[model samples]
Target: DQQVKQNSPSLSVQEGRISILNCDYTNSMFDYFLWYKKYPAEGPTFLISISSIKDKNEDGRFTVFLNKSAKHLSLHIVPSQPGDSAVYFCAASAFAGNTPLVFGKGTRLSVIA
Candidate 1:
C-alpha cells in the first residue's frame, strides 16, 4: 500500500486566489513532511516542509500544515500566480539521516490568468 496519498488529482484557481492541496499518510513513523513542485520536463523542487514536532511551516507564499494525530498534511499557496502552475507532490520520511523520501502521486495545479 502507498504510504502517502494525494486524493485530488488536479486543482484549478484564478490568479491572485488561494490554492490548497491536501495529502494523507499511513505511516506514523514519518516525522518530516515535504511538498515538492514539478514542472514539465523538469525535476521536482522542494517547496516547504514541516517537522512532526511543529504544526505548521511557512516560506513566503508557501505554507505547509501537518496534523500528526490525523496523519494528514496540506499545502497552501496565497495569491496564486500563473508560474505556480505545476504538479505538487507530498512526501514524507523518518527522522533518520539520509532516509529516502516517500512521495505521493501528486496533484496538478493550474492557475488561470
Candidate 2:
C-alpha cells in the first residue's frame, strides 16, 4: 500500500523555537522522500528532500532525516516563525519523472508570536 503517514494533524510552537514533524511510510518501494509546505488553496512547494541512499539532508532552516530501516522520517524547522504557519505534507516517490507522488493528509503548523 502506497501510504505515507503523517499522524499529527496540527502543531503549535512559539516563535524562535524549533518545530518538528514526523512521518512514516508503509511502502518499502519508496526511495525518495520530500517535505512540502502549503498555504491555503495553494500548491505545495518543494522544501527539502533526502534520497534513500542518504540518511539526512539539510537546507537552510529545514532539515529532513530518513531512517529506511524503520520506514520513518522527520522534518525539523529551526527558529520557527509566524510565516511558517501552514500545512506541511509528507510525500514519497518511488521513481522520478512521470510517476505519481503519494502524499499524506498533512500537518498544520502554527507558530505563535
Candidate 3:
C-alpha cells in the first residue's frame, strides 16, 4: 500500500492565482510532516513543515494544513508565479533530526506567466 500518495502528478495555474496540492498518508505513526520544492535536476529543498501537534503552519505565500485525524494534508500557494513552477514533494518522518522520510512521488506545478 502507498503510505504516502499524491494522486495528481501535475497542476497548472496562471500567475498571481492560487494553487492547491493534496496529499494523503496511510501510516498513523508519522508524527512530523514536511513539504519540499524542487526545480529541474536539483534535489528537493525544504519548504515548510508541521508537527502532528499543530493543525496548520504558514510561511509567507506558502501554507500547509495537516489533519491528523483524517490522515490528510495539503499545501496552498498564493500569488503563484512562473518561478514557483516546480515539483513539490510531501514527506513524513516519525522522528526529528536526520530521520529518513517517506516521500510522495511529487506533484509538478506549472505557473504560467
Candidate 4:
C-alpha cells in the first residue's frame, strides 16, 4: 500500500493564477513534509517544506501547509509561471532529515502562458 498519494495526476493553471497541489498520507507518524519540483529528465528539486510543529511555511511564491489531524498537506504557488510547469512530488518521513521518505507519484502541473 502507498503511504503517500497525490490524488490528482495532473493540474493546469493559467499564467499568473494560483496553483494548488494536494497530498494525503496514511501514516500518522509522518511529521515532516517536503515538496519537490522536477522538470522532464532533471532531478526533483527541493521546493518548500513544513514541520508538524508548524501549520504553514512560506518561501517566496511557494508555501506549504500541514494539517496533522487530517493527515493532509498542500503546496501553493502564486502567480504561476510557465517555468513553474513541472511534476511536483510530496514526500514525508516520520523523522526529520535522518530517515527515508515516502513519495507520492506526483502531480504534473502545467502553467499555460
Using all chains and alpha carbons, the TM-scores for the candidates as numbered come to: 0.96, 0.94, 0.95, 0.97
Better of 3 and 4 by TM-score: 4
Candidate 2 per-residue lDDT, tens place, 61-111, comes to: 899999999999999999899999999999998864235789998999999
What residue pairs are clashing in model 3? none
Task: List pairs with backbone clashes in candidate 4.
Answer: none
Query: What overall lDDT goes with each candidate model?
Result: 0.94, 0.92, 0.93, 0.94
Off by over 4 Å in 4: none
Model 1 steric clash pairs: none
- Report the C-alpha lDDT of model 3 over 31-109, residue by residue, as the tens digit: 8999999998898999999899999999999999999999999999998989999999999988552568999999999
Off by over 4 Å in 3: 96-98
Per-residue lDDT of 25-76 in model 1, one digit per residue for the tens? 9988898888999999999998988888899898999988888889999999
**Global Cα RMSD, each model:** 1.0, 1.4, 1.2, 0.7
Candidate 4, run of 10 with poorest lDDT: 93-102
lDDT per residue for candidate 4 within 1-113, as digits (tens), equals 99999999999999999999999999888888999999998999999989899999999999998889899999999989999999999999886645698899999999999
For candidate 3, what is the lDDT? 0.93
Please say which candidate is ahead in TM-score: 1 or 3.
Answer: 1
Distance from true location, Cα of 100 in model 4, Å: 0.2
Best-matching candidate per TM-score: 4
